[model samples]
Target chain A: MRPPPKSWPPTKGSEPLPNAPRIAPPVSAARPAGKLRGARALSGPLPWLLPALIMLGLFYLYPIAEALRLAFTDARLFDQATEPSLDSIRRVSQSAALPVILQNTLVYTVASVLGQLGLGMAIAILVVRAERARLRGTMALRTLVLAAWVIPAIANGVIWQLLFSEAPFGAINSALRMVGFAPVAWLSDPSNAMLSAVIATIWQGTAYSMILLYAALKSIDPALNEAAAIDNATGFERFWFITLPHLRAALLVNAILILIMTLNMFDTILSLTGGGPGRATEVLSLFAYNTVFQSFELGRGAVLSILLLIISLTLTAAMVVFLPRERK
Target chain B: MTFRAIPAAFALLATTAPVWAEDLITRNRVGPADAPNALTFRLTAFDLYSADPATAAHFGDLFTDFILAHPGWRIDTQLQTGAIAQEQARIIEQTRAGRGPDCAMIDSSQLATFKEAGLLAPMTPFFTQEQIDDLFPFVREGVTDANGDIAALWWFTDLRVLYRDVTLVPEPPQTWADLQQAAEVVAAQGLEGILFNAGRDEASAFDWLAHFWAQGGELVDDTGRPVFFEGENREKFLSAVAFFADLVESGAAPRRVTALSSYDDLLASAVAGSTGMFIGGNWMYNQIQITMPPEQAANWAVSELPGPTPEQRATGTGGWTIAALTDDPAKTEICAGIAQLYAGPGNAFQGLLPTSVSLFEEFETFAGPEFDVFVSALQNGRARPSVPIYPEISNQIQILLGNVLSGSMTAEAALDEAAAEVMAAYERL
Candidate 1:
């Protein structure tokens, strides 16, 4: 799979003008990909750029090509690749579990985005107000929230899985029972399982949203806030009128990033639920992973992967169009 | 440095180099390559290999023995995962990537898939005729191919059984009604009861399928096509699912049982003393010994898993096996020797049951009266279908358990849906 080796200082087959050679050119033993330029005309700066180009082709370009190739073929574990066909796409389309997987993906992405933004905005405002009043424990509180964010995703899953265990065994459920509430199956039930995963995701992600909104809040002019206060504005009035507008750009950016990340979330949920309780918590990424790695249906996995990629790209493009333009 | 020596060096490289299996497939290896004496052979290690300190010490002592017996030989084992299915998945993945272990320890159910994929070759050469003859009758039939060659050597086996605290339930449950009644009484006393794996795991299917098997129900036809939905098999399947569902419905067992993926989880609950009765593996006893106080461990006892009727009784046997992936005859022979260590001496201290009929006769550890239930249960024990398509059937069965337990679908609907999926997978194959 390696590209043919390149030799420096073109010898007998140099195609450039023989009269005036500006510099000795490096010739590729093979033609450049896609005929972007002639083999001989690949001159000036290209030789210097060859290493980067090769790395890009090898890592990014080649993998995409192979994935695309596999998507149209029949592939399996320890089986030889066969003729190009639409069998994998057909298999995915005909899957009895596809609809539920897609629905879970949508619910997970939306719930995670909303939960993170709502909780993140609340924390951001509280921290900013405390900082303005010069209150105690402001830094400590921020650090605590960031601590959840800094833990690895897998560890986050394990911690939450323990906390969400059933009844007397679960920390949260035990606390609930102590307060005269009946135990709830946080993970055993399908609906609660998705909710549990969303809560864990929001707990980990809220810090990033908080940091973004915090920076935006600090960017606002202090004089404007004083003027608003002089204008007989209530605390809520200032927050609604001035602070919300200032945070709009950050919030939009945060929403877009969070949605994409949640769409592809795998590790935490994998450790927590493993798409269990009858594939109730299986999202798009987990479905693709199980299909390819666990089921050993390479073609089916590739098809699912392409569908996920298309969904992410389309959403990103749509979100980009709504972004506030910078002044020229 | 001399031109005359170049040919001699090329000859040396050719003689020492590994002979790859396919089109330029390099046998991936990593270790101290410059070491003068030792050669590293990466072997697949089970997740249970180092699950606890005692287990680590006991399992480690065997490797220490192997190294002592063969100087300059190193064993590099990895690919440990908590769930058996995950471990199985990793084995196939590693082999697909050409980084597979030189000797792989895999679940017995995976042998057919490995053989069909051409990932395995005849193991007969490495094994002695006498050693081959020493395998348990069922194991011998299970391991040998149609060509009269040994495909793999099973090291150990286990059985599914229903466990209970004898003090909590003075009488063992022999039928579904008895199990439900016993659980209800325990539930009245503020204790959990009648738990089993009903999760998205193989145990969800493997553990409960024995109830159907006890009634002489066929999950698949002789040709290896699923027929659990046809005629008497249909009634058997529905009755098995409904009985468990009825327990959950009657508040005899919690819906949280659907979340357990491993017997180790069930063992943890049993050790905590909240559980009155649960369906689990014989190995859980060994785990309880390592983890629980002796008095607490003694309180627990196992019986043949309950059946639909008191007259019916069966236990499903499952085990792990070792296969040599190396084509080199020398390494294959070494792997065979290691397999013997696992089947006889290594399994002795690990709490795993011996796969050799002769060894089982002499092992004093299994001579106790309590283990009689397990030894007797083996008479009616059945193994899961070992066809390549069995994974598909087992996967759908796992989903069927999850869906039925979570109240997402009815038993009839779930069974029909699972059957449709299995048939679809069969057509693809």
Candidate 2:
């Protein structure tokens, strides 16, 4: 008696056993179509996702296409003439504002994502640890963080503005004065203004990451921790080996979402700094808004919106491709 | 065991019969809310109409008179709280959709753009030649369209004044140098020396325009091209920026001035007793009186905006205008009549000066010393250039002020940059 050749996966073009289960039905065979129509040419999820596809096409695809069309035209907000030209592109390209705005957007988004992720991970772990130890008031802590998350960005802007305002109006400055320290220009200085905006965004956005990472943390088996303890694994070693590997997918999802949110952030910065102290906190989204509404140059604004859309999509695509490689 | 549905329906109709019958009369028979007139006048007014009791009462009186003639003329009003520019933008959108209100209160500077868009019906059908003659020069100029028709009624205006806390600044500064020194003294005393609307908004641009005008600088030519950077005008522009730059650099004005977008903000600081002097509109003083304690309000007074020298004087006057946006003659007439009810240089809602010849004499408070300063300021008062490209110029100027105030760019560099941006936009036009 002999074991046949020990190759596990069948090689290409290898013959299958006569009694082996058939891989799907033969294409030549006809199947009755009721619910699952696998054999059909238009098979699988496309039909199931038709409604969402239609929505995306109508809302997302159409707006992007229209914006692209408008980008090359000379359009003012109220003007009816729609002559196609490169003036919008030329204006944005030659604009001194573009460089400053892009830099601000980058700084704001990167700082916000990093802050949200790191603070979120730490909070999520602490809360889970406290719950395991039967600590009280963890629910209250969660509610407070969630309160910041639930607040509208515009309201957050006003709240942060009052907190960041100078001497008499701002609590922060008043406290510094009480402590016999010179008041920091939280909203007046360019660098300070950007920092203030980033900090405010992080506070508002950290809840999103915390909830996601918390769910991931809960999914991690307590048995694994016990086993690692039995192996005499240190606290850091257990977290690095058992907990972090389990959270890889959530962290990736959280980073991508936070990146998109921070990139699109405008309402907070708008009310907080209004992109001032000399365009120091002016992100791309706000720049586009000012171009269209404030400056009334729709063509140039359209050009800026397209640039923003490209950056958002490119970053999302990169995260999709790059983040998964870490898993390997 | 159950009641019949018919009786319940009958009871419901009986309960609402009066309301339904009244509504039917308003919608179908004669006038909606009033007498026999079959028209409803829709107006989009600023927030004061809805928010201020005095303003609402004044309109209430006007409506009482209107219904006597228009009998059955129902009034429907919508209120907006945004600044004039936003209100104008909203109207423009509705106008494009062919669904604008019969009447809209717009910023005076918006008149030119509205006319260019063909969104306004000529006010000549409403305002008479005699009425036109009575308007302030800037109002007359602003309301007149390219075809020489009065397009909108500029009812009230506010003049930029040099506001001072009398305790901090004994006398109003008459010139830039005097202002600089006075503000320095205030700043040295640990008070905010001066404040102005310098944020990226119409107010900031409108406020800064006086500085250029005081130097005899013109922003645009007859062809609507920007002439601000040409020859001597360039020097004037440079000098104007330098004057403000000096205020910021010498600690006379706080660096926050670059971001102070609204007179409302300056008013807040003034009422809190932190501000020493500021250049603000006359309405700001009126607000101070309303919100500040009498003793505090007494310390605040307004004078005409200072100039390069005491003899050189100029001021910026901005006002709101009401326009008939509908082509329906009947609706337009109703709109015109409504506007005329409160027409003159008076606002019941805010204590802004009349836009034209006085009709506010009925109110004795209009005779106050602050208004006397406003009256003199009217002599040099000018409206913003209503040309469409003026917004672009203002936007660039906003950036320039921010740059110079931050000490990021020199005055010359900032001016050149602003000029280049404005010219590029002009070329595109």
Candidate 3:
């Protein structure tokens, strides 16, 4: 409101000496023209960014537009007539299996994300509290935990498949037999298939959540913890009040990412149970894939994909709004 | 030379040597000519290479010979690996893009889909009427398009047969009752009586259809409407499903078969001595030789699938059929020649049952008595319904079989459910 203090602009002599520093105006009170100049300075890299922008428009935006367009038509893989119709949307709504598939999808996504977050948080906390003498061993354990995440999803699915195989040679079944227990149908039975898939997913997914939370945990002030320790606060109380509150940002980010990934899981389920032993683990993604590729119904697949996109966007928006803001 | 010159020389060699070496190898293999052009032929049944390496080797040798025969032309056999449904989808994409292979080894069951889409070129221009007539009736009927023209050439094929452990069974089943009796005897010995696909998948559909046909059931009536929902046909369908259910109920087969997928799994179970019998293709013999130790493999023997009556032998035939896809007429003619050569009498040693009836006698000498059973089964083998709706119907049947196998539905209820679904799919088509 009033002119800033004379020293705010750096007091200067009446005679302008050669190579003297200039008295610049305050940034908050800069003129509109000066603001335009600031914006123009940021545009220097625009030409260099053109190729990336064009690529994203072509590969990402174009497919999304095409899917939206196809969602309104009754198109198939081999059909000649693709008349504009809402029949695909109607069919999806009327499908008896849709309700079951949607429920399965929700269960898989929620269970997988929570399992990953819980296990990852535990591992991250343990790693943070490890003694300096055991740092090497802790680091090795972290690497071993992340190894499953580093492999391809298909390879991970195959490894789990072998472990849960119903055959006598299956690792889990063989171990059970060794312990004088009957072998369980880990993948074959309807009841166990979803649980088996969720367990495998948690194994592959926890590593990512751990890394993010671990980094966030490292940034928390140790002095707060020392103060709490001096107060004779329990370890659980320290974690619940201090460590958890500090991890809110990382937790929100990790949860949203893992939620989207779990919703879109296709290849792993495909290579594992294939949505079967009678559609026991047939989630929305698998249902959409089968509708398009197996049933040759492209329109139906597009509609389901749009539905998935809506759910993902809603969850992301909710997380962004509810997550705590970091103070500057 | 200077040190910099030596590094430059090494870089030059790395860049230039492989290209020159490849050129020399290509020239030596294809022979010197103007410019060797690649004739890309997509093969759908690439698993045959793993199933029978000798047959695959023969195919490659024949392809090389054909390339040499045509100057300036080299053959490229592109292996497209997937389940039959996935491979068919790939072919549809290729054709819709107007970038089809020069030729493709297609599945006989899939010819109807391709023919309907106009993806296959008619063979009327290439083969004379007499030559076309030489093809067996079922083979001719299977590849005929809507225009009543042969769109593909039938090559090697196989029919489902009952395979049993010779030491366990001592006598092969000749009828449904015989099978039940044999199964009981085998089960009494603390071994599983049968191993077959009963899951909700393509393999289940194919394996179950053999029994369906054997019981005198028809998939579609004369007008192309599915008839399995009607009285007599419906009864037969129920009976066929009940057979597998009864097997599990009677402790002749393991309850685990409700989750079994492919004949490969059946072979594994058989090799492990968990099951005494299974219904599979003649190719199972080749697979057994590949997967099992010699002592275990020697225990297996093949026989015609037992029917409702001993005299009524029935099975379903399926295998690869060669179809021309090139737009160029000259290339089409060349593709026809290659197709004929591969399916012709000269390579019977490959062990696939030749479609040529004339070669049967010669094939028998080396094919042995086990293959004679396959040949006899083919005489009465029913071709799958060649319609666009067949895949949908197959899916419905798979669901029905899975329901029955899992004991979730009575045979009657499952059949009714499947019939309604099949009819719905047919109406949509």
lDDT of 1 by residue, A1-328 (tens): 9865543434456564456555644434444665545644566688889999999999978887887888897676656457898988888898889999999999999999999999988998899889999999999999999999999888898788889988356789989998999988998999999999999999999998889888888898888889999999998999899888877788889888888888888888887877878888989999888776556677888888889888988988898887788999
Model 2 TM-score relative to the real fold: 0.87
Task: Write one digit per residue (lDDT tens) for candidate 3, span B1-429.
Answer: 999899999999997564345432231233233335755677754422435576556655665566557766655556677656777778787878887677888887777777777888877788888877767678888888878887888887877888899899978899887887888888899787887776656667877787888877888887678888688898888878887778878878766676677677788778788778998888888788778889988888888888878886688888788888867777677778877776764337556777767766655444576766777788888888887777767777776676677666677876776666555445445
- What DockQ does model 3 achieve? 0.33
Deviation (Å) of A188 in candidate 3 = 2.7
Per-prediction DockQ scores?
A: 0.39, 0.34, 0.33
lDDT of each: 0.78, 0.79, 0.77
**Cα misplacement distance, residue A292 of candidate 3 (Å):** 2.0
DockQ of 2: 0.34
lDDT of 3 by residue, A125-185 (tens): 8888883346668878789889978988877877888788776566898999999999887
Off by over 4 Å in 1: A1-57, B1-58, B83-87
As a whole number from 0 to 100, the lDDT of residue B311 in candidate 1 is 75
Q: Is candidate 2 or candidate 3 better by DockQ?
A: 2
When superposed on Cα atoms, how far off is each prediction in RMSD? 9.8, 8.2, 7.0
Q: Let me know the TM-score candidate 3 reaches against the reference structure.
A: 0.86
Give one digit per residue, the lDDT tens place, for model 2 in B247-349: 9889999887766776777888887888898888877776888898888888887788889999888998887777888877777777777667656312644
